[model samples]
Target: MNLIRPDKIIVGMIHVDALPGTPNHQLSVCEIARKAALEAKLYHDEGVDAIMIENMHDTPYLNKNADHEITAAMTVIAHEVKNAIRLPVGIQILAGANKQALAVANAVDLDFIRAEGFVFSHIADEGMMNSCAGELLRYRKNIGADKVKILTDIKKKHSSHALTADVSLLETAKAAEFFLSDGVIITGNSTGEAVEPSDLAGLKSEIKLPVIIGSGISNENIYTYWNQADVFVVGSHFKLDGHWTKGVDPGRVQKFMRTVHSLRQ
Candidate 1:
């Protein structure tokens, strides 16, 4: 479990284009893997601190236990990405497939996973998502994947929290910390949206685990969040025209990395 220990880490996102069996699957698995490996290499060369691979293009993601085809395709892509870079690599299966991600991470020797619905219940686009900390941790233990870290997302994106309105974000973070999450992630309402600065401050004050900002980080705004978050997980801003739907633009990645390095100094 000896992972990146920097006070602040910058994670570039490798949103693996839609995999086989998903709605947007356009290329073969080999093609997808090659594209992902290229992106990982680009991030590594650009001096990114770490990288995370996510199924972001798989629109209309499934709930827990995504299709076996999705898992198989991801495993192949992750293996390629891991082999292509030296930096710590993580995986995130879209929707709330925590255990599936763990399985894929374990299979491909990934360092960590971004898990949604690790604690507490909320309505997601997929459906109602119940807390999976108990089942997920037990499964992780049973599968002997303890070395893989699980960073849980609290009050995650693309969801409604009316049920947890009585509980504060800090309280939800506390629940995640109590549940033994290796880290806690905070995101905006949806993808590519900036997280509230006050929310990051509140979570840092209330939680002891590492705090990661999961979306909407760009070269233009890195300085504002550089000191507040332990990790900045960026995706959309690194793509062409700053859109998530586009492919990773190496120039954008380099510019963001330069800004991050300057701020780090």
Candidate 2:
């Protein structure tokens, strides 16, 4: 896999509500891809170092097979997004769908993947997710997709790792590193919620691998975690009216970039 260190990484999030095969919000599959691809292009133009496309708006996500249409649709849109953007691309198929994400990365030439359970799993919005490293790592090998990196999300968004409550935060980071994760991401419990800087600090101390903040970054508290986190994944803040469901907000993107640049300088 091409090296993508976290410190210099700034990712623009593109949320597509529509499932791969079906129309979402009254839009056709092709339309959904067009909108998402265009949004991806916008993020690239805004100077984000990377773009990750997720089907966040698609609700009631299944842990098993997506209909043929869903996979087909995701494949098509992912292809278009790759064509439109010059930056490295990544993908996340939600609800613990690590294999699907790997498949998408392979089909689309995405640089990396954001999988829910590349290591251990706890209760998630979908249910108790089991570890997938066994199946996921082998699938990647079988597909001949060693070039794509897998960026695992530790204690992912919209869920809890309470089942692992007995485990120390630092221990969790150690476990992820031992699993051979290329990188690890830390996110708030839900979208736009601020991740406590202390959590990042603890995770950073335990693992030598690159760490990324997965959500809730804005112009406000970004500086607080700047030193702890190597990469920042931003989405809602860059959306219309700061709404995740709306279109990309160029002004917000520019504003956030300015603040981040100021800090780096």
Candidate 3:
């Protein structure tokens, strides 16, 4: 958990395209791995603090454990990206496959995993996603992978929080901290959307763990959250045209890093 210092750390996202067995599957596993490695290199060269590889294109994501093929493919891609870049790398399996992501992180010697549905139940695109803090921590312990930090999403994107409507986002973050999460992720309604500073401030005051902004960061808005957020998880803005599905744009990455560095000084 202390691996990342409490600064405006920038964690780039390598949104790996659909793996085999998913509905959107297209490229061969090797091709996908190559592309991921390339993106990892780009992030490293651009001085990104860390990078997280996710199975974002694997549409129609599962609410439970992912298939063996999906896990295997992610492992392969992660391994390649790990070798390609010196920056710390992490993994996040779509929809709430926390255990699978942990297993992959363990196998690839990754620094961490981005877990969804870590605190409360909510309706995600895949289905009703349940909390995994208890089960996930136990599994991480059983496997002796305590070195792998779990940065969980509280009130995660692409989900409805009607079930936990009575509770506040700050309380949800407190629950995550109580569960011993390495850090807590805050995000907008969906991918590529900007996180509200008020929401970021709310969670910052409530939890002692690292408060990471999980989406919608760019050179344009980085100044706003530069001092408020501990870490920024950027994906869409790094891509060409600021779309998650597009290839990484080196210029965008360079611009973002420059701005972040200036703020640090």
Candidate 4:
């Protein structure tokens, strides 16, 4: 694995999931593709560091391989978005689809990937996910895809950490560092909720790797975590009227941009 890079402001998320075959999330890939590319391009235009494409809609999560339909749709969209935006591109395949995400990134020349359960087990809405850091790292090296960094979810969303209760969040983060994760992410246990400042503080005390605020970052509280987190993957807050299923709210994205830019000033 390559060394993790800090001192960056990566921001983006996968907001569309109702691709060709899936529709539960109230969006089709066709609807989301052009719109999401335009939205991501807008963020790039605002000078955000990096953008990640994910399948945030294929809900009722599966802890394993997603149907080829989901992967194919994301590949097409990721390619289009990469072409549209100037910043680094990344991908996250929903429901613990790490290998598939890697495959897609490789196919589309994405710069990185967000992997859930990169190390240790977690009880997700779908079920348990065992650590794949050892295998994933080796696989990346084997396939000569080591240049693509893996931003691991230290304590991922939509899950319970009771299984790792004896293990502190920082401890789990340490294991990921040792296992060679390029960076770590902290979530609020679900979408649209901010990661606890205390949790962020605790993890910060333990690791030097790049840390990201994974979910619930928005115009309201992004200021709070801006300096603390290297990147912010925001989605729900950027949607139309604050609804995750609605179209990209350029107004919301602009508001976040203004807030973040003000701090730099």
Q: What digit string (tens of lDDT, one per residue) describes model 2 on residues 14-110?
A: 8876674444446777887899888887887777788888887777777634566666777887898999878888888766777887888898888
TM-score each candidate: 0.97, 0.93, 0.97, 0.91
Regions of candidate 2 where Cα sits further than 4 Å from its true position: 1-7, 20-25
Least well predicted 10-residue stretch by lDDT in candidate 1: 1-10
The digit string of per-residue lDDT tens for model 3 on 171-244 reads 99899999999998889999999987888765666668888899988899989987677889999999999999
lDDT of 1 by residue, 1-265 (tens): 3433554788889888888887878999999999999988888888888889999889888877689999899999999999998989999998888888999999989999999998889999889999999999999999999999999898888999999999888889899989999998999999999988878775666777888899888888888887777888989999999998888899998888878777767
Residue 259 in candidate 1, Cα distance off native in Å: 1.2
lDDT by candidate, in order shown: 0.88, 0.79, 0.90, 0.79
Ranking 1 against 2 by lDDT, winner: 1
The model with the greater lDDT, 2 or 3, is 3
User: Which segments of model 4 are wrong by more than 4 Å?
Assistant: 1-8, 23-32
- Using lDDT as the measure, which candidate wins? 3
